[model samples]
Target: MINASGVLRTPRQTLFWRVTNCAGAQDSARIFRVEKYFSPYTPIKSRKSMNKGEFVESLADRLDVSRAQADRALSAVLDIVAEQLAKGEKIAFTGFGSFEVSKRAARTGRNPQTGATIEIAASSVPKFTAGATLKAAVNGK
Candidate 1:
């Protein structure tokens, strides 16, 4: 990277290295034409979110199994987790995470539109706590 003529410049470079030519004189500092390539169309991957279908596809590809089989397996796993959670049972996957039901106490909330107080009923919601391995994986370990 070089700044010249009040312009921020990036030398033409590949992912790992850049190309620069030193003039005939070895003593001279290399004068490299700094040209940055910025493509507006280059896709910026903000996040890799896997939907249910994409997840099934990934599972199928990884397991070398049919899509239907993968889908069924995913469905079964989800169903079992839901069943266990509904029964107030916690499911823990060693080093992965734990899934359980969290209960929210009933409360009163103000309605924004009417400025009126409303009663919010208590409810149970599914919750997941990431385990050590899962946290490590997310942190790029």
Candidate 2:
């Protein structure tokens, strides 16, 4: 609800947080309300996915390197992984994970739209199995 001062008010909290410089507005501090409960639409904190650019920027900042260098390093790592996987070789980083190519056999499958049978051709795809350290890190251990 909008209060008399044009600030959003939430029924659960009598005191609201004041935020300035919102959306380039030059008015006084405004209050933005937050939900008291979580809904399905609310974002999950544990599984937020970072985009490639953001990841690269963060890596650069952490390593004290330029973004260009970080980008090149990231690309080289990905290229090497792709090359190894293409050769049916596995790439392993002891505490991180391993990446390899796996084969899928051709099989008959059903078409969901028309309820018809379909054939799935055999192919090879890259797969990654996380190592113990990575698993522990993800689980907040």
Candidate 3:
């Protein structure tokens, strides 16, 4: 069982790594390392914000591409995404998620403490809906 604040009270199962074979006379055949697998209900940490330059460098390292090429590719892809969203279109990537623009209706809101009435303007904002696979992985299913 786990609490709302992410503290585990009881675990249903535990895992361990075991050595299966020994190729040499000096090699040890039996070694175990315990591993705790989080339950499906565990909460995940949110990702930190990354600027374009940092994103490019990370992608370059992961994809084995030059930083310049990664920058260009990343910029182009982001531009395309922004352009599609600007045109009120939804972009879907398999195993990832869907990005779409949602419209918020204008409404009256109050200023806290001051109790002043304020007019909130209607606006369109981008939203993401995670795909099933990604959602499952996040939930540790």
Candidate 4:
């Protein structure tokens, strides 16, 4: 079973068998398999949490450019995004998503490893909300 937090509690074999038998099932199983094998349960530095190499490669193919060029373009785009967000401007890409600045209120949290209380400072952060097209595509709609 999957939790509200998007964690799968079932064994791999169980998930595999169950997903494989479903007719025309979306490839969530493949995604889970890739995530399981490729990435560890570590904190991601950015909000998007995408794998850089894979993102660059895919962009290269889509944009018909070299990987290096794709990487540069992606970096440039991200830099622009960050700049706009820093200025409290909202950015919207027609088919992809919108990025807006959000204010996170200061809150108290616990350090899981040490069991110590910690204060999380209030801050403005960029948040992304996927467009309907992107969401539908991800959901195989």
Candidate 2 regions with alpha-carbon error over 4 angstroms: 1-47
Give me the runs in candidate 3 sitting further than 4 Å from their true place.
Answer: 1-51
Q: Best lDDT goes to which candidate?
A: 2
**TM per candidate:** 0.67, 0.68, 0.61, 0.55
Single out the weakest 10-residue window by summed lDDT for candidate 1. Answer: 8-17
**What TM-score should be assigned to candidate 4?**
0.55
List, residue by residue over 1-141, the lDDT tens digit for candidate 1: 434333333333222223456556364665664344344443435335658998999899899999999999999999999899989999999999999899999999999999999999999999999999999988889
Q: How many clashes (backbone atoms < 3 Å, residues ≥3 apart in a chain or on different chains) does model 3 have? A: 0
Judging by TM-score against the true structure, name the best candidate: 2
Candidates ranked, most accurate by TM-score first: 2, 1, 3, 4
Q: List model 4 lDDT by residue over 1-141, tens digit each.
A: 655544454422212112223446566754322233213443333335458898999999899999999999999998999999999999999989999999999999999999999999999988999999999998889
What do the candidate models score in CA lDDT, each in turn? 0.78, 0.78, 0.77, 0.75
Q: After superposition, how far is residue 124 of candidate 4 from its true place, in Å?
A: 1.5
Across 78-139, the per-residue lDDT of candidate 2 in tens digits comes to: 99989989999999999899999999999999999999999999999999999999999999
Off by over 4 Å in 4: 1-50, 110-118
Query: Who is ahead in TM-score, 1 or 4?
Result: 1
Candidate with more favorable, higher lDDT: 1 or 3: 1
